[model samples]
Target: MSRVSDTEPCGTETAVRSTRPKDLTSRSSFGVLGTLYSAGEQGLALDAHRSLSRSTLLRLRDRRTGAFIEEFTAWADGFGEYRVRLTARARRHYAHHHACYRELYPDIDTPVPRPTDGAHGGLVDHRADRDPARNLLREADVLVLDALIRLQGGEIGRLQKPPIGRYQRGTSPEIGAMPPGLLYREAEKLANSRKPISRLLQHPDGPLVAVVEVTSLLPWAATGSIPLPALIVLTTRGRDHYESHLDSYRRAYPDLDLQLSRHTM
Candidate 1:
Protein backbone atom coordinates (compact mmCIF):
# COMPACT_ATOMS: atom_id res chain seq x y z
CA MET A 1 0.00 0.00 0.00
CA SER A 2 1.26 3.52 -0.76
CA ARG A 3 1.65 6.03 2.02
CA VAL A 4 -0.45 9.19 2.08
CA SER A 5 1.44 12.48 1.83
CA ASP A 6 1.73 14.61 5.00
CA THR A 7 -0.01 17.46 3.19
CA GLU A 8 -3.16 15.29 3.18
CA PRO A 9 -3.45 13.20 6.34
CA CYS A 10 -5.28 9.90 6.20
CA GLY A 11 -9.05 9.78 6.78
CA THR A 12 -9.42 13.39 5.72
CA GLU A 13 -11.95 14.45 3.08
CA THR A 14 -9.33 15.53 0.56
CA ALA A 15 -7.36 12.36 1.18
CA VAL A 16 -10.51 10.31 0.64
CA ARG A 17 -11.61 12.08 -2.55
CA SER A 18 -8.21 11.79 -4.18
CA THR A 19 -8.15 8.02 -3.66
CA ARG A 20 -11.74 6.88 -3.41
CA PRO A 21 -12.37 3.29 -4.45
CA LYS A 22 -14.50 3.20 -7.58
CA ASP A 23 -17.55 1.80 -5.82
CA LEU A 24 -17.41 3.53 -2.45
CA THR A 25 -19.42 6.62 -1.58
CA SER A 26 -17.89 9.56 0.31
CA ARG A 27 -20.85 9.28 2.68
CA SER A 28 -20.08 5.63 3.46
CA SER A 29 -18.23 4.90 6.68
CA PHE A 30 -14.75 3.40 6.43
CA GLY A 31 -16.28 0.16 7.77
CA VAL A 32 -18.07 -0.11 4.45
CA LEU A 33 -14.92 0.35 2.31
CA GLY A 34 -14.43 -3.47 2.03
CA THR A 35 -10.87 -3.46 0.59
CA LEU A 36 -8.97 -3.87 3.85
CA TYR A 37 -11.17 -6.80 4.83
CA SER A 38 -9.32 -9.91 3.69
CA ALA A 39 -12.50 -11.97 3.73
CA GLY A 40 -14.35 -9.54 1.50
CA GLU A 41 -11.34 -7.99 -0.26
CA GLN A 42 -11.52 -10.02 -3.45
CA GLY A 43 -15.17 -9.31 -4.09
CA LEU A 44 -14.71 -5.69 -3.03
CA ALA A 45 -11.61 -5.45 -5.19
CA LEU A 46 -13.49 -6.95 -8.13
CA ASP A 47 -16.34 -4.55 -7.51
CA ALA A 48 -13.95 -1.65 -7.14
CA HIS A 49 -12.59 -2.41 -10.59
CA ARG A 50 -15.91 -3.41 -12.11
CA SER A 51 -19.12 -4.88 -10.65
CA LEU A 52 -20.15 -8.14 -9.04
CA SER A 53 -23.50 -9.70 -9.77
CA ARG A 54 -23.51 -11.62 -6.50
CA SER A 55 -21.85 -11.83 -3.10
CA THR A 56 -18.63 -13.69 -2.36
CA LEU A 57 -16.32 -14.69 0.48
CA LEU A 58 -13.25 -12.82 1.72
CA ARG A 59 -10.85 -14.65 4.01
CA LEU A 60 -9.04 -13.00 6.93
CA ARG A 61 -5.67 -14.49 7.81
CA ASP A 62 -3.90 -14.60 11.15
CA ARG A 63 -1.97 -11.35 11.55
CA ARG A 64 0.80 -13.14 13.38
CA THR A 65 0.86 -16.56 11.74
CA GLY A 66 -0.22 -15.68 8.20
CA ALA A 67 -2.40 -18.77 8.48
CA PHE A 68 -5.94 -19.07 7.22
CA ILE A 69 -7.98 -17.88 10.19
CA GLU A 70 -11.57 -17.06 9.29
CA GLU A 71 -13.74 -15.54 6.55
CA PHE A 72 -16.65 -13.21 5.84
CA THR A 73 -18.91 -12.73 2.84
CA ALA A 74 -19.18 -9.57 0.76
CA TRP A 75 -22.03 -8.23 -1.30
CA ALA A 76 -23.30 -4.91 -2.59
CA ASP A 77 -24.56 -2.41 -0.02
CA GLY A 78 -27.42 -1.52 -2.44
CA PHE A 79 -25.83 1.89 -2.82
CA GLY A 80 -23.70 1.01 -5.83
CA GLU A 81 -20.96 -0.18 -3.49
CA TYR A 82 -19.75 -3.45 -1.95
CA ARG A 83 -19.44 -4.19 1.77
CA VAL A 84 -19.41 -6.94 4.40
CA ARG A 85 -22.20 -7.61 6.90
CA LEU A 86 -21.61 -9.20 10.25
CA THR A 87 -24.23 -11.82 10.93
CA ALA A 88 -25.13 -12.29 14.59
CA ARG A 89 -23.83 -15.86 14.62
CA ALA A 90 -20.56 -15.03 12.87
CA ARG A 91 -19.92 -12.08 15.18
CA ARG A 92 -20.56 -14.24 18.23
CA HIS A 93 -18.50 -17.14 16.99
CA TYR A 94 -15.59 -15.71 15.07
CA ALA A 95 -14.83 -12.19 16.30
CA HIS A 96 -11.74 -12.34 18.43
CA HIS A 97 -7.89 -12.26 18.62
CA HIS A 98 -7.63 -8.75 17.19
CA ALA A 99 -6.76 -5.26 18.50
CA CYS A 100 -9.04 -2.20 18.47
CA TYR A 101 -9.03 1.56 19.30
CA ARG A 102 -10.91 4.07 21.43
CA GLU A 103 -10.55 7.84 21.69
CA LEU A 104 -10.95 9.70 25.02
CA TYR A 105 -11.71 13.39 25.07
CA PRO A 106 -9.81 15.51 27.57
CA ASP A 107 -12.76 15.22 29.94
CA ILE A 108 -12.54 11.43 30.37
CA ASP A 109 -10.67 10.06 33.37
CA THR A 110 -6.98 9.25 33.04
CA PRO A 111 -3.94 8.64 35.26
CA VAL A 112 -2.51 11.82 33.81
CA PRO A 113 -4.47 14.95 34.76
CA ARG A 114 -3.91 15.84 31.15
CA PRO A 115 -4.94 12.79 29.14
CA THR A 116 -2.93 14.19 26.22
CA ASP A 117 0.32 14.59 28.16
CA GLY A 118 1.81 11.09 27.71
CA ALA A 119 3.68 9.35 24.88
CA HIS A 120 0.32 8.00 23.70
CA GLY A 121 -0.79 11.65 23.46
CA GLY A 122 -4.30 10.24 23.60
CA LEU A 123 -4.15 7.49 26.23
CA VAL A 124 -3.74 4.42 24.01
CA ASP A 125 -4.13 0.88 25.25
CA HIS A 126 -4.56 -2.62 23.76
CA ARG A 127 -7.38 -5.01 24.58
CA ALA A 128 -8.53 -8.39 23.25
CA ASP A 129 -12.29 -8.76 23.50
CA ARG A 130 -13.23 -12.11 21.94
CA ASP A 131 -11.58 -15.47 21.10
CA PRO A 132 -12.85 -18.25 23.37
CA ALA A 133 -10.68 -20.79 25.04
CA ARG A 134 -10.38 -24.24 23.51
CA ASN A 135 -12.07 -26.87 25.67
CA LEU A 136 -10.16 -28.06 28.70
CA LEU A 137 -7.85 -25.04 28.59
CA ARG A 138 -6.99 -24.30 32.19
CA GLU A 139 -5.27 -21.06 33.11
CA ALA A 140 -1.95 -22.93 33.55
CA ASP A 141 -2.41 -24.72 30.24
CA VAL A 142 -2.16 -21.58 28.18
CA LEU A 143 -1.05 -18.05 27.42
CA VAL A 144 -4.54 -16.56 27.50
CA LEU A 145 -5.66 -13.78 25.16
CA ASP A 146 -6.07 -11.31 28.04
CA ALA A 147 -2.40 -11.69 28.98
CA LEU A 148 -1.15 -11.85 25.40
CA ILE A 149 -2.90 -8.63 24.40
CA ARG A 150 -1.45 -6.67 27.31
CA LEU A 151 2.00 -7.83 26.20
CA GLN A 152 3.52 -4.69 24.76
CA GLY A 153 6.42 -4.16 22.36
CA GLY A 154 7.15 -7.83 21.86
CA GLU A 155 7.76 -10.27 19.02
CA ILE A 156 4.62 -11.64 17.46
CA GLY A 157 3.75 -15.31 17.93
CA ARG A 158 1.10 -17.81 16.88
CA LEU A 159 -1.14 -20.21 18.75
CA GLN A 160 -3.15 -22.95 17.17
CA LYS A 161 -5.77 -25.29 18.57
CA PRO A 162 -5.72 -28.94 17.67
CA PRO A 163 -8.22 -30.02 15.06
CA ILE A 164 -11.65 -29.71 16.59
CA GLY A 165 -14.07 -32.48 15.85
CA ARG A 166 -17.76 -31.87 15.48
CA TYR A 167 -20.44 -34.48 15.64
CA GLN A 168 -22.49 -35.07 12.52
CA ARG A 169 -26.18 -35.75 12.79
CA GLY A 170 -27.79 -38.20 10.41
CA THR A 171 -31.07 -40.02 10.54
CA SER A 172 -31.03 -43.78 10.89
CA PRO A 173 -32.04 -45.68 7.73
CA GLU A 174 -35.22 -46.76 9.53
CA ILE A 175 -35.92 -43.17 10.48
CA GLY A 176 -35.14 -42.01 6.97
CA ALA A 177 -37.90 -44.30 5.80
CA MET A 178 -40.36 -42.20 7.80
CA PRO A 179 -41.72 -38.75 7.03
CA PRO A 180 -39.34 -35.80 7.66
CA GLY A 181 -41.04 -34.87 10.94
CA LEU A 182 -39.13 -37.83 12.41
CA LEU A 183 -35.83 -36.13 11.56
CA TYR A 184 -37.16 -32.89 12.91
CA ARG A 185 -37.94 -34.66 16.18
CA GLU A 186 -34.40 -36.02 16.25
CA ALA A 187 -33.02 -32.52 15.71
CA GLU A 188 -34.44 -31.44 19.04
CA LYS A 189 -31.88 -33.61 20.78
CA LEU A 190 -29.05 -32.08 18.79
CA ALA A 191 -30.35 -28.59 19.48
CA ASN A 192 -30.49 -29.27 23.16
CA SER A 193 -26.96 -30.64 23.07
CA ARG A 194 -25.36 -27.50 21.71
CA LYS A 195 -22.85 -25.66 23.85
CA PRO A 196 -24.17 -22.65 25.73
CA ILE A 197 -23.59 -19.21 24.20
CA SER A 198 -20.53 -17.44 25.53
CA ARG A 199 -18.74 -14.15 24.82
CA LEU A 200 -15.38 -15.74 25.69
CA LEU A 201 -13.97 -12.95 27.79
CA GLN A 202 -13.02 -12.79 31.44
CA HIS A 203 -14.01 -9.99 33.76
CA PRO A 204 -11.93 -6.79 33.62
CA ASP A 205 -10.03 -8.02 30.57
CA GLY A 206 -11.97 -6.54 27.67
CA PRO A 207 -11.55 -3.10 26.06
CA LEU A 208 -12.56 -0.13 28.24
CA VAL A 209 -13.85 1.49 25.09
CA ALA A 210 -15.91 -0.34 22.47
CA VAL A 211 -14.24 -2.69 19.98
CA VAL A 212 -15.43 -1.52 16.59
CA GLU A 213 -13.31 -3.66 14.26
CA VAL A 214 -15.33 -6.85 14.81
CA THR A 215 -18.02 -5.24 12.71
CA SER A 216 -15.74 -3.59 10.18
CA LEU A 217 -15.99 -4.37 6.47
CA LEU A 218 -12.66 -2.64 5.79
CA PRO A 219 -9.27 -3.07 7.50
CA TRP A 220 -7.58 0.32 7.39
CA ALA A 221 -10.24 1.92 9.55
CA ALA A 222 -9.33 -0.27 12.53
CA THR A 223 -5.66 -1.09 12.26
CA GLY A 224 -2.17 0.49 12.42
CA SER A 225 -0.88 2.86 15.11
CA ILE A 226 -4.12 3.79 16.79
CA PRO A 227 -5.24 4.63 20.34
CA LEU A 228 -7.76 2.07 21.71
CA PRO A 229 -9.46 1.05 24.97
CA ALA A 230 -8.71 -1.56 27.61
CA LEU A 231 -12.40 -2.69 27.65
CA ILE A 232 -15.88 -2.02 28.98
CA VAL A 233 -17.89 -5.18 28.47
CA LEU A 234 -18.01 -8.26 26.25
CA THR A 235 -21.49 -9.45 25.44
CA THR A 236 -23.20 -11.88 23.06
CA ARG A 237 -22.89 -11.51 19.27
CA GLY A 238 -24.90 -8.43 18.42
CA ARG A 239 -24.29 -5.70 20.98
CA ASP A 240 -21.63 -4.19 23.21
CA HIS A 241 -22.65 -2.18 26.26
CA TYR A 242 -20.80 0.90 25.12
CA GLU A 243 -22.49 0.73 21.73
CA SER A 244 -25.92 0.08 23.24
CA HIS A 245 -25.65 3.14 25.45
CA LEU A 246 -24.00 5.41 22.91
CA ASP A 247 -27.15 7.41 22.38
CA SER A 248 -27.61 7.90 26.10
CA TYR A 249 -23.97 8.83 26.47
CA ARG A 250 -24.33 11.41 23.75
CA ARG A 251 -27.41 12.80 25.46
CA ALA A 252 -25.78 12.85 28.88
CA TYR A 253 -22.25 13.75 27.95
CA PRO A 254 -22.94 15.76 24.83
CA ASP A 255 -19.41 16.98 24.55
CA LEU A 256 -17.94 13.61 23.48
CA ASP A 257 -18.12 11.60 20.31
CA LEU A 258 -17.11 7.99 20.84
CA GLN A 259 -16.17 7.05 17.33
CA LEU A 260 -15.00 3.64 16.27
CA SER A 261 -11.41 3.07 15.21
CA ARG A 262 -10.46 3.89 11.62
CA HIS A 263 -8.95 0.52 10.76
CA THR A 264 -9.86 -3.18 10.97
CA MET A 265 -6.90 -4.91 12.55
Candidate 2:
Protein backbone atom coordinates (compact mmCIF):
# COMPACT_ATOMS: atom_id res chain seq x y z
CA MET A 1 0.00 0.00 0.00
CA SER A 2 1.99 2.91 -1.29
CA ARG A 3 1.11 6.42 -0.18
CA VAL A 4 -0.55 8.45 -2.92
CA SER A 5 1.87 11.33 -3.42
CA ASP A 6 0.52 14.84 -2.94
CA THR A 7 2.75 16.02 -5.77
CA GLU A 8 1.27 13.61 -8.30
CA PRO A 9 -0.54 15.40 -11.11
CA CYS A 10 -3.94 14.14 -12.35
CA GLY A 11 -3.27 10.67 -10.88
CA THR A 12 -6.88 10.04 -9.83
CA GLU A 13 -8.22 11.45 -13.11
CA THR A 14 -6.06 9.06 -15.12
CA ALA A 15 -7.09 6.09 -12.98
CA VAL A 16 -10.80 6.92 -13.33
CA ARG A 17 -10.69 7.23 -17.13
CA SER A 18 -8.72 3.99 -17.49
CA THR A 19 -11.15 1.90 -15.48
CA ARG A 20 -14.45 3.65 -16.33
CA PRO A 21 -17.10 1.21 -17.50
CA LYS A 22 -19.08 1.74 -20.73
CA ASP A 23 -22.23 2.58 -18.77
CA LEU A 24 -20.56 5.05 -16.37
CA THR A 25 -20.03 8.67 -17.27
CA SER A 26 -16.86 10.64 -16.28
CA ARG A 27 -18.68 12.23 -13.30
CA SER A 28 -19.66 8.87 -11.75
CA SER A 29 -16.21 7.49 -12.42
CA PHE A 30 -14.68 10.32 -10.38
CA GLY A 31 -17.17 9.61 -7.59
CA VAL A 32 -15.88 6.04 -7.29
CA LEU A 33 -12.29 7.25 -7.23
CA GLY A 34 -13.17 9.71 -4.44
CA THR A 35 -14.56 6.92 -2.26
CA LEU A 36 -11.39 4.84 -2.53
CA TYR A 37 -9.08 7.80 -2.01
CA SER A 38 -10.98 9.06 1.06
CA ALA A 39 -10.82 5.65 2.79
CA GLY A 40 -7.08 5.34 2.22
CA GLU A 41 -6.45 8.86 3.47
CA GLN A 42 -8.37 8.11 6.68
CA GLY A 43 -5.75 5.57 7.95
CA LEU A 44 -7.22 2.37 6.43
CA ALA A 45 -4.50 0.14 4.99
CA LEU A 46 -4.77 -1.82 1.78
CA ASP A 47 -4.62 -5.36 3.17
CA ALA A 48 -5.32 -7.58 0.18
CA HIS A 49 -4.56 -7.17 -3.52
CA ARG A 50 -5.42 -9.75 -6.18
CA SER A 51 -5.86 -9.81 -9.95
CA LEU A 52 -9.26 -10.57 -11.46
CA SER A 53 -10.28 -11.12 -15.11
CA ARG A 54 -9.78 -7.53 -16.27
CA SER A 55 -9.44 -5.84 -12.89
CA THR A 56 -7.63 -5.92 -9.55
CA LEU A 57 -9.23 -6.62 -6.16
CA LEU A 58 -8.20 -4.47 -3.20
CA ARG A 59 -9.28 -4.95 0.41
CA LEU A 60 -8.80 -2.21 2.99
CA ARG A 61 -8.14 -3.23 6.58
CA ASP A 62 -7.90 -1.30 9.83
CA ARG A 63 -4.23 -0.92 10.70
CA ARG A 64 -4.85 -1.42 14.41
CA THR A 65 -7.31 -4.36 14.34
CA GLY A 66 -6.44 -5.81 10.92
CA ALA A 67 -10.15 -6.15 10.16
CA PHE A 68 -11.46 -5.83 6.61
CA ILE A 69 -13.13 -2.42 6.36
CA GLU A 70 -13.79 -2.08 2.64
CA GLU A 71 -13.17 -3.96 -0.64
CA PHE A 72 -12.79 -2.37 -4.06
CA THR A 73 -12.57 -4.05 -7.47
CA ALA A 74 -10.37 -2.06 -9.80
CA TRP A 75 -10.76 -2.44 -13.55
CA ALA A 76 -8.21 -1.57 -16.24
CA ASP A 77 -8.61 -0.96 -19.94
CA GLY A 78 -6.38 -2.32 -22.72
CA PHE A 79 -4.07 0.71 -22.30
CA GLY A 80 -3.24 -0.15 -18.65
CA GLU A 81 -5.51 2.45 -17.05
CA TYR A 82 -7.56 1.82 -13.80
CA ARG A 83 -11.03 2.47 -12.28
CA VAL A 84 -12.55 1.05 -9.05
CA ARG A 85 -15.90 -0.36 -7.94
CA LEU A 86 -16.97 -1.05 -4.34
CA THR A 87 -18.10 -4.68 -4.19
CA ALA A 88 -20.28 -6.73 -1.80
CA ARG A 89 -18.54 -6.21 1.55
CA ALA A 90 -18.49 -2.41 1.38
CA ARG A 91 -22.04 -2.21 0.05
CA ARG A 92 -23.54 -4.54 2.67
CA HIS A 93 -21.79 -2.84 5.60
CA TYR A 94 -23.41 0.50 4.79
CA ALA A 95 -26.84 -0.97 3.97
CA HIS A 96 -27.24 -3.02 7.17
CA HIS A 97 -27.75 -1.99 10.82
CA HIS A 98 -24.49 -3.43 12.12
CA ALA A 99 -22.50 -1.05 14.35
CA CYS A 100 -19.12 -2.75 14.74
CA TYR A 101 -17.49 -1.19 11.68
CA ARG A 102 -18.57 2.38 12.50
CA GLU A 103 -17.72 1.82 16.19
CA LEU A 104 -14.22 0.74 15.21
CA TYR A 105 -13.54 3.28 12.47
CA PRO A 106 -15.65 6.34 13.16
CA ASP A 107 -13.86 8.78 10.87
CA ILE A 108 -14.08 6.84 7.61
CA ASP A 109 -16.35 8.41 5.00
CA THR A 110 -19.75 6.98 4.07
CA PRO A 111 -19.56 5.61 0.51
CA VAL A 112 -21.49 7.12 -2.38
CA PRO A 113 -24.30 4.79 -3.41
CA ARG A 114 -23.45 3.01 -6.63
CA PRO A 115 -25.40 3.73 -9.79
CA THR A 116 -27.15 0.91 -11.65
CA ASP A 117 -28.36 0.43 -15.23
CA GLY A 118 -32.07 0.98 -15.86
CA ALA A 119 -34.37 -1.36 -17.89
CA HIS A 120 -34.44 1.02 -20.85
CA GLY A 121 -30.60 1.03 -21.18
CA GLY A 122 -30.00 4.43 -19.60
CA LEU A 123 -28.03 4.91 -16.34
CA VAL A 124 -30.31 4.98 -13.29
CA ASP A 125 -29.17 7.03 -10.33
CA HIS A 126 -29.63 5.47 -6.88
CA ARG A 127 -28.10 8.22 -4.80
CA ALA A 128 -30.15 8.67 -1.64
CA ASP A 129 -30.90 11.95 0.12
CA ARG A 130 -30.52 10.29 3.50
CA ASP A 131 -27.24 10.07 5.38
CA PRO A 132 -26.29 6.48 6.19
CA ALA A 133 -23.49 7.50 8.56
CA ARG A 134 -25.82 9.56 10.75
CA ASN A 135 -28.29 6.65 10.86
CA LEU A 136 -25.54 4.22 11.84
CA LEU A 137 -24.32 6.56 14.54
CA ARG A 138 -27.80 6.72 16.08
CA GLU A 139 -28.00 2.92 15.96
CA ALA A 140 -24.66 2.54 17.70
CA ASP A 141 -25.86 4.92 20.41
CA VAL A 142 -29.01 2.82 20.92
CA LEU A 143 -26.89 -0.31 21.40
CA VAL A 144 -24.91 1.42 24.11
CA LEU A 145 -28.11 2.60 25.75
CA ASP A 146 -29.44 -0.98 25.76
CA ALA A 147 -26.24 -2.18 27.39
CA LEU A 148 -26.64 0.43 30.11
CA ILE A 149 -30.20 -0.73 30.84
CA ARG A 150 -29.09 -4.34 31.14
CA LEU A 151 -26.27 -3.34 33.48
CA GLN A 152 -28.78 -1.67 35.79
CA GLY A 153 -30.65 -5.00 36.29
CA GLY A 154 -33.53 -4.09 34.01
CA GLU A 155 -35.09 -6.82 31.88
CA ILE A 156 -35.56 -5.67 28.28
CA GLY A 157 -38.56 -7.91 27.54
CA ARG A 158 -41.27 -9.68 29.53
CA LEU A 159 -43.86 -12.35 28.77
CA GLN A 160 -47.31 -11.18 27.76
CA LYS A 161 -50.68 -12.94 27.32
CA PRO A 162 -51.48 -13.86 23.71
CA PRO A 163 -54.59 -12.65 21.90
CA ILE A 164 -57.83 -14.60 22.54
CA GLY A 165 -58.45 -15.35 18.88
CA ARG A 166 -56.73 -18.00 16.77
CA TYR A 167 -53.59 -17.27 14.75
CA GLN A 168 -54.20 -14.95 11.80
CA ARG A 169 -53.82 -16.11 8.21
CA GLY A 170 -50.62 -15.41 6.26
CA THR A 171 -48.58 -15.13 9.46
CA SER A 172 -44.84 -15.31 8.85
CA PRO A 173 -42.71 -17.93 10.59
CA GLU A 174 -40.91 -15.22 12.55
CA ILE A 175 -44.13 -13.65 13.83
CA GLY A 176 -45.59 -17.03 14.83
CA ALA A 177 -42.40 -17.96 16.66
CA MET A 178 -41.89 -14.59 18.31
CA PRO A 179 -41.68 -14.68 22.11
CA PRO A 180 -44.71 -13.04 23.74
CA GLY A 181 -43.57 -9.54 24.70
CA LEU A 182 -44.29 -5.88 23.97
CA LEU A 183 -40.57 -5.02 23.79
CA TYR A 184 -39.79 -7.19 20.80
CA ARG A 185 -42.89 -6.13 18.89
CA GLU A 186 -42.27 -2.46 19.67
CA ALA A 187 -38.63 -2.78 18.61
CA GLU A 188 -39.69 -4.32 15.30
CA LYS A 189 -42.17 -1.50 14.72
CA LEU A 190 -39.57 1.15 15.45
CA ALA A 191 -37.04 -0.51 13.15
CA ASN A 192 -39.57 -0.85 10.34
CA SER A 193 -40.41 2.84 10.74
CA ARG A 194 -36.70 3.76 10.59
CA LYS A 195 -36.95 5.29 14.07
CA PRO A 196 -34.36 5.11 16.85
CA ILE A 197 -34.99 2.68 19.76
CA SER A 198 -33.54 4.95 22.45
CA ARG A 199 -36.95 6.56 22.89
CA LEU A 200 -38.61 3.17 23.30
CA LEU A 201 -36.40 2.36 26.29
CA GLN A 202 -37.41 5.50 28.14
CA HIS A 203 -39.77 5.12 31.12
CA PRO A 204 -39.84 7.90 33.69
CA ASP A 205 -41.03 5.48 36.37
CA GLY A 206 -38.60 2.67 35.41
CA PRO A 207 -35.07 1.94 36.66
CA LEU A 208 -33.62 3.99 33.81
CA VAL A 209 -33.29 7.39 35.47
CA ALA A 210 -32.30 9.54 32.55
CA VAL A 211 -32.31 9.71 28.77
CA VAL A 212 -28.80 9.18 27.37
CA GLU A 213 -27.07 10.07 24.11
CA VAL A 214 -23.68 8.58 23.27
CA THR A 215 -21.45 11.48 22.21
CA SER A 216 -18.67 9.27 20.85
CA LEU A 217 -18.01 5.71 19.57
CA LEU A 218 -14.32 5.31 20.52
CA PRO A 219 -15.30 3.94 23.95
CA TRP A 220 -16.43 0.59 22.46
CA ALA A 221 -12.84 -0.64 22.84
CA ALA A 222 -11.73 -2.06 26.17
CA THR A 223 -8.22 -0.69 26.08
CA GLY A 224 -7.08 2.29 24.02
CA SER A 225 -5.66 5.79 24.32
CA ILE A 226 -8.90 6.99 22.75
CA PRO A 227 -11.13 8.78 25.24
CA LEU A 228 -14.31 7.12 26.45
CA PRO A 229 -17.65 8.16 24.92
CA ALA A 230 -19.50 10.86 26.79
CA LEU A 231 -23.09 10.34 27.91
CA ILE A 232 -25.38 13.36 27.76
CA VAL A 233 -28.00 12.86 30.42
CA LEU A 234 -31.44 14.39 29.87
CA THR A 235 -34.07 14.37 32.58
CA THR A 236 -37.39 16.11 33.28
CA ARG A 237 -36.14 16.93 36.75
CA GLY A 238 -32.85 18.58 37.60
CA ARG A 239 -29.54 16.68 37.33
CA ASP A 240 -29.50 16.38 41.13
CA HIS A 241 -32.72 14.36 40.95
CA TYR A 242 -30.89 11.52 39.17
CA GLU A 243 -27.53 11.77 40.93
CA SER A 244 -28.34 8.94 43.35
CA HIS A 245 -29.36 6.55 40.58
CA LEU A 246 -26.44 7.52 38.39
CA ASP A 247 -24.06 6.95 41.29
CA SER A 248 -25.59 3.57 41.97
CA TYR A 249 -25.17 2.60 38.32
CA ARG A 250 -21.50 3.59 38.43
CA ARG A 251 -20.91 1.68 41.66
CA ALA A 252 -22.70 -1.41 40.33
CA TYR A 253 -20.81 -1.48 37.07
CA PRO A 254 -17.37 -0.04 37.64
CA ASP A 255 -16.04 -1.58 34.44
CA LEU A 256 -18.43 0.43 32.31
CA ASP A 257 -16.25 3.30 31.10
CA LEU A 258 -18.30 6.40 30.34
CA GLN A 259 -18.12 10.11 31.05
CA LEU A 260 -21.45 11.53 32.18
CA SER A 261 -22.65 15.08 31.65
CA ARG A 262 -26.04 16.66 32.25
CA HIS A 263 -27.95 18.84 29.79
CA THR A 264 -31.39 20.21 30.61
CA MET A 265 -33.88 21.53 28.06
Best-fitting candidate, scored by TM-score: 2
Q: In model 2, which range of ten residues has the least summed lDDT?
A: 118-127
**Steric clashes per prediction:** 19, 1
CA lDDT of each prediction against the hidden true structure: 0.24, 0.31
Model 2 segments more than 4 A misplaced = 1-49, 52-59, 62-123, 128-229, 232-265
In order of appearance, the predictions have TM-scores of 0.17, 0.19
Model 1, 74-129: lDDT tens digits are 44564343333433322221222011101312222212211221112221221111
Per-residue lDDT of 107 in model 1: 25
